[model samples]
Target chain A: MTERMQNAADAGPGPHYLALRDHLAGEIAQGALAVGARLPSERQLQLGSGAARGTVREALFQLEAEGLIYRRDRSGWYVSPPPVVYDPTRWAGFMAYVAEQGRVPTTETLGKQSVAASAADAAVFGCAIGTPLFALDRRRAIDGRPVLVERILVDPVIAPDLLDEGLDGSLTAVLTGRYGVRVVRNHVEMRPCALIKDVARALGVASGTPGLLVVRRSFDAGDRIIEYDHEYWRHDAIRVLVEVRTRD
Target chain B: MTERMQNAADAGPGPHYLALRDHLAGEIAQGALAVGARLPSERQLQLGSGAARGTVREALFQLEAEGLIYRRDRSGWYVSPPPVVYDPTRWAGFMAYVAEQGRVPTTETLGKQSVAASAADAAVFGCAIGTPLFALDRRRAIDGRPVLVERILVDPVIAPDLLDEGLDGSLTAVLTGRYGVRVVRNHVEMRPCALIKDVARALGVASGTPGLLVVRRSFDAGDRIIEYDHEYWRHDAIRVLVEVRTRD
Candidate 1:
């Protein structure tokens, strides 16, 4: 429990677990406990709070449920990193922001292929039902922690031999430089989701963990759909940031 | 199981459950099953597919886990609503957008009080410790289904008697009309979250259901923080949209 929480417990009537939970939450918000910092073990917290072991455990579980802390297998609990800010309105790619924040960013191409679009993909791509599209699946990480899985579908006609070119690094840059496809606008949507078996395995989190499902449909100067992207981000690893200004 | 799914099961090499799941998913995506439309009961699906009852149950569970459907108390499964588009960049209110979408919107004031800011709240509001702020707790609905719980913190100094002004209706309208506080810009952050116990009770969902936690810091004409609002939205109810123009 934080000192403030302890004091509140003495002055007020909430339970010990409540006080401890608030205290830890306060510590996290105040930056006294930095992101990705390994928290003291449950035994240590119990000793510090002088609370029962069960109370400490419950408090830790509460923090995890709140998405404030997370645990890796066999490794003890760690304070979650503050969510990285993503502004969908900007044309910037993942590399720009992650590097700007002084964190190492990397992308691993998991799979790449040329596939025939199904009826649904055709509708999304505004092409015939059997048009061939390039599909690129990649895992993105910041500071060696896997945070996002990106599944991108591109118009192969616009960027022929796109799959022959190396698929690593910033795909956005590749789209502009190699493919000559200029992204003019994007329509994005955000949804809360659970990590199903495949995505959960790729992200190294539990199957049912909460996540953010972001779908982006990008258009070129011709207003043609250039890319349809699905990004599954670990809930704790990123924050969606946008500024709204009144249009004059 | 959908007819397409059954057909795919006959033609493809995937498992029975996969075909069924995709069929249902396709139906939802294609708008064959409109948002909030209940799916066929397990018995109906089973009888149609000639699948065992357990297999039918498994497919429904898969859809729910994928965030495609949800069940209400004794009401059976309903197709998750298409997420309402939310553009935080605009100076609009919940009532405006919900109504524009042809859905009825209502706000219920749950609690209101003037409280001294905690250290964290103080920092967000850019005020000294112990500043008096009016906190408004409200639940918002679209078409009579609760979709959001808003916890708003405002500087009472700017809108004294705001509570006495009655805490219902569009808060943005109230700020402009009553207090003359012109909301100039808003910085919003979205995070995937699981509903905690209190919020779960308020939204009538299971405690661990996924949700979107949106934190908006509103600045007035003077560039001072006017409101720090946290809106918890049901995962299926809203999709955030933003348009970012290059500063240049």
Candidate 2:
């Protein structure tokens, strides 16, 4: 442990916890700790580093903050995979993109229900208040780790009996194949957010965990709103990419 | 306090801490607590709610996670302002967008240096390794609160005296006016990140604070990479909006 501390000191100068953090971060960056690899227990780390429990925990927390690792409730810590790159302008659905990125993707339907659109919903959907909408809640996982929870509100007028369809597949594919409704445009808004209780529970994280909130309004050929979606993603799970080309 | 708890209970069924969180969230949502308003001290909140100290803190942590409030070290909590809407596809610079949203914006140049590009920088710039470059670091604030820190690297060959110019203003304006270099296109990538020690100190937040990282490569009329920027934003500071329309 003293020799390891000496190596950490050579890496940089800081508090004891910071040295520990630097050492661990170096190991992760160098792939000594592979992605999805479970970390040693905190007790083990404390014993190995000769640091107090609180110091060891603080170092681990720093690594977590840096998106190098994550914790599951009662399951222990694991190295986080590289974030999936997401281009919002692309039309490829979630399943296709995740698969293209060489990761296994799966979705589970958490809930489905009929809902009455509120005034805010009416404004966004360009429909009258009280309009019936199909609401679907789903949890998506990459490599068997839950990363995002999404709620989709569909205008029942566009896709009748949508709730009866199998929802584990891509909703976009379903809309295009069944209803001939193609999303030609999207208005997306993303921000940093903290997970609420229900969403946190769905993603298997704490309620106050920092997250990324992405809201999308999808439109069809005639520019009519087809679906509105709210996605709550684990903060470390994805990276958004965008490209803008100048018009000639 | 009991009456407040009763009101919270009416809102939802949850633990005492959750009820308290709900009650405060309701107030913020209803505008009873305005943006940028300082929250009551924890002691005051404890006295007012008649909740235990830990319970009060737990509720506050929940609210913080919800992006309703934020804490400054050694300072009490404050109501987080509505995030400034950021459209990466738009050509307008940060100052313009921030002012358009009715908020004050300010920038300060933190450091400037002349450097030799590394292999990674060389690849990004399409220049040879050890090519001379100018690096600039700046901090941007909204309504007197530091919200982002940005590091920009410029191909010095394009603008020989880049480091000598006043950097407190928009670099886009400077590039266009001084070098006749207009940024006609941009490739942007964004992800959730944790602030490292130096950046966190500049933003007055704890090291490893959750943040958003946005990296942009700006191109000129010839499609040459003119500038590369890495921006670290407070996670709660901005919301990104993008509009994508399919070609007819």
Candidate 3:
């Protein structure tokens, strides 16, 4: 056993888990374990630290709670990557921003359908409750890890053939190219929420996992609401940055 | 028993909890149980719903995960209030914003101390490492429930004698009133994180609870970093809104 593991074993049961947690945290902090690297199996961790299986699991749980690591169902734990910086004020598309940050971005179209607008949707769109709305579900990933799931709702009158176009790419580009609609402004609201069942399944996290919900209403030059988007992001996957100057 | 409880009883063990969860969720949605209202005890819920104690607890757990309810240690659960809207681009202070939302706001100064700047702090403040800084810790509440804990770090060179003033009120007012330091701009970064032990304790939540961490660096007209703040908010307490317009 290593000296740190020996020390953890000497510390007895109560503090043993903390020692292990600190040891692994130190490894990640020192870049000994790079981001997205899979951790050893629980049995291996237990054996390596001379700690009980429960103690090893507790240590791993602490690290997960600290946002340093995460577990995939049935899959092993892995170090978490640094959060991607998102600036909604920039009006950049997802592909543009992620690439600018030097990260690989991918989008998968999950499904699409035509749905009647609900009362809340009608209020936002200022249309009849049963107005036809095209709903597109897409999952976005960074470095092969799924990070967010978005449901984009577009009024059918605004983009009649939107469903026929390719959607495994940036919707911003498609809106500008096909519909000649340039998004001029957006009103965004974000809150911490829990992942619903469908979103959790798509993101490969357990239902009820904490998440960040961002709702954006995009408007065209004439102040027409062009698209409404609901984005559910993994709690650790993104950091929101905003710079505000005092109004003159 | 009410018809809803009878329906839950007939739904079998697996779906029984879901029925109860939906019932309570409906109550919360319709405002039958107003925000911040205490929930019935677990035993009471079990007796009322005619379900197993585990089933009642499971339903409550689901609601908590949905951000519709929350627990307060030994205290019983309470209905979660609507999130207070926060617009960082506005130059309003905490008291101003919360009251504008029609919610009561209160602040309590927890403690204060002088600390030397670390490498990261020095980088942000453009000061030498080990420079003296004033650190003020405060907890803010809405409707009698603590929601956030903030640590404000001030450069003593810019706002000397700041520690000697009353901090139970908005620091923005103190900065303008006493120090003649008007914050002209701010850079804010926010992310969902797990609450550390001390912060969780102060907010009366369990350690490692999901939280929203917001870090703001406020600057003066001369572009001097005046105050750097770290705010840890309950995951369900606030919503962030930002309206971005296309640059001309």
Candidate 4:
């Protein structure tokens, strides 16, 4: 090794906080910082990078906020486990997804009842204003982390009184059990949206936090936009996958 | 409006800076803040919101950085137009995209080319490691705003001289120009991704910026993964829409 290389190695780093962040990033890229790797404490980073205590802590906070790392109070920070790449092609439902991951799934229905549709809501739902529709506001959490907030609009003609039933657990299950409505296919549109009003409060992020706006319409055996819903998801909490194929 | 509503509206907001941001956000939501609307100067905002000059400037910087606003040197900040929603499923080729929008399309190669496939990449392209390939990195801007950075891994067996032509313009056009290879269909997977360093820099965002990871496997008339390309796009720069029907 060159004398300069040796000296540089012995000296640890050139810039304190930047150097520590760089090392961690490199480790993550090389899989050295494997998914769920428990990162060293702030004190350890201070020692490792020869930086001030405040600098080390700031770097850690930035990474955690970005979803690259997480903290557990006395337990300190740890590498955030990568989000499971959810393939839309698989067409899995909420219940199936949670079961596969072996996580206890819970739903808190903020409100589940018929509401008069607004003009914008009516147009999207293909109905007129004052049309009684089942509107559900659901907050979904996995392992106690708020992952997504969804507002689902269901057509009443297809599944009557869906709103009246006290919804629990899976959304798909409610449709199937109450009205025998099955989702044979679905179409989705993905867009970028800033959180508004209730969605922001539910996700525990500041109002106007950037989020993924996923507009999905479920179809039955016949083609129709029966269930149109809007999902505002925590960006780090979910990853969507799509597959494209060649046409003959 | 009720007197209570008027008081709520006129009350001195807790934070002057936040109130300004909220006002702009409300205007945008109401369609009153049209795209390219020039915002008031920092002094004007400070006077209007009862905030410090530093606080007002900070807010403008944040808005400009987020693509919600931009500065034209001495001209000050203005609202940016909403980004185009790009549907990879509806069409094929970058050239076609511009043409479809009635915009002029162009290309400019930015970096060197190479050939060597990783195990994962090999599987995606149905090729072997060390397969003759053209690795091209391209930065594409629509109407002068840098929107996407694409890294294309092309199978040289199909078009050996792909490297000879810099991937500045339409890749699909180049493939067709050289080898009768046309992208008749594409399988696209859309997922949320934090940007990599190089891609983030090219897209004018901070490292690990939240963007879209769209992996498209292009195919000709015959079913084949002709080329496997990874496209990184700014979240607001594009949207993905898919239309589906029940399988008979």
- What is the C-alpha lDDT profile of model 3 across B1-248, one tens digit per residue? 11222223233233677788978987887899898899999999999999999889878976786678998778999999887899877888889999998999999998787876755678888888777788888899998889999888898887788889999999989988998888889999988776645677888887766788889999988899888998889888989999999997
> Per-residue lDDT tens digits of candidate 2, residues A151-177?
788999889989999999899889999
Give TM-scores for every candidate, taking all chains together and pairing residue i with residue i: 0.89, 0.83, 0.84, 0.71
Span of 10 residues, lowest total lDDT, candidate 3 chain A = A1-10
Better of 1 and 4 by lDDT: 1
Ranking by TM-score: 1, 3, 2, 4
DockQ of each: 0.45, 0.40, 0.37, 0.26
- How would the candidate models be sorted by DockQ, starting from the highest? 1, 2, 3, 4
Off by over 4 Å in 2: A1-31, A39-63, A72-77, A115-119, A126-132, A221-223, B1-26, B41-59, B115-119, B126-132, B221-223
Best-fitting candidate, measured by DockQ? Answer: 1
User: Candidate 1 docking: what grade?
Assistant: acceptable
- Candidate 3 — which pairs collide? none
What's model 2's lDDT at A182? 86
Candidate 1 yields a Cα-based lDDT of 0.78
**Model 3 docking grade:** acceptable
Q: Report the lDDT tens digits of candidate 1 across residue range B55-87.
A: 777677668766788888777899976567888
Q: Over the stretch A59-94, how does candidate 4's per-residue lDDT look in tens digits? A: 664454345775444576667665545555566776
lDDT of 1 by residue, A1-248 (tens): 12222233232346677688888888987889888888888899999999999899777766876678988865888888766788787668889988887888899998887766767677888788667778888899988999988788898888887888787788878888987887777788787887765677888887777888888888876889888888888888878888876665
Q: What value does the lDDT take at residue B134 in candidate 3?
A: 86
Please compute the TM-score of chain B alone for each predicted structure, in the order given: 0.85, 0.91, 0.88, 0.75
TM-score of 4: 0.71
